[model samples]
Target: MATPSSPFSFLGDLFNTIGERLQPPDWAVHEIQNRAVLFLNHVLQQEPEAQQRLLRQQGRVVRFQWRFVTMELVATPAGLLDLAPAGSVPELTLTVTDDSPFDIARAALRGDKPAVQIIGDVQLAAEVNWLVDHVRWDVEDDLARVIGDVPAHTLGNAVRRVVGALRQFVGSRTAGKAGGSAVGPAGNAE
Candidate 1:
């Protein structure tokens, strides 16, 4: 008897093919980068220690690359991040090692950091690592500002549960593949 393949297995290949062939326009990429910078600044502002740490690295550029996309950000004197000017040389470069979006997403959902290749200034890399270890966006607080505290808390709990379920499901699937035993949703080997 032959095992059935997942219906969604083609999605990974489909996405990779599309990504390789279809590059977004420069203007759109720039706009998205600007918005990302804005969001980063907002999160940094919420953490005073993070700001002070970034302030220590003022004017230093950090470049992040994943596949074909890259973004460079410079630490400002005010402790916020801004998009680095085009052609600006970076003190540190961090490239995500994962080539597949599905793998990256799975790792993230499992609360694992994607492997990264770091090159450049040691101190800058340390600072970036510290920021990564410490800085997290308080989505619940942001949501509370829009909706009420109770609703935000409830929504946050719901989302967390859903994410937890996804993490378990992904973990089981990975384990089943590796161990050569199919694991059902209830986590029993079939």
Candidate 2:
């Protein structure tokens, strides 16, 4: 007897098909890339060391690719990021190896980095890895600037709890599918 197929597998295929067929307008993609650069700059500004490191690599472009989407960013002299000029060649390219969105999300929720294939400048890639390891956004602090500290703390705690619950649920589901071993938050089998 053949094993039953997953009921939700079709949804993944449907989403992939739709995503491939329906490309966003170039203008919208440009605007979104601009916003992403702004947000990245904002986060970089919070870490002086990150900015200093980036400043050292000024003019070097880094390209990120996932599926059909690609974004290229160049380091500025001021230690901030900006969109690379069209047709600019990247010194380093980082491509996410994972093709499934759900798997990516699951890995993220489990506090794991998705598999990535790195190509090009080793120094640039090392700097980028350092930035990723050191820099983090203080979401609660940002929220507190708009609201009050007490409310922001409470909300942050709630959000953390919800995320923890989601992590647990996803872990359990994955474990059920893969025998009995569960993957922990660190992506190690438990």
TM-scores for all candidates: the values are: 0.91, 0.89
Number of backbone-clashing residue pairs for each candidate, in the order shown: 0, 0
The candidate that achieves the highest TM-score relative to the unseen native structure = 1
Candidate 1's error at 160, in angstroms? 1.2
lDDT of 2: 0.92
Question: How much is the lDDT of residue 118 in candidate 2?
Answer: 99
Candidate 1, run of 10 with poorest lDDT? 1-10
- Candidate 2 stretches with Cα past 4 Å from truth are 180-190
lDDT of 2 by residue, 154-179 (tens): 99999999999999998777766688
lDDT of 1 by residue, 1-190 (tens): 7766554557877888899999999999999999999999999999999999999999999999999999999999999999999889998999999887878998998788999999999999999999998999999999999998999999999999999899998887788778888867687755
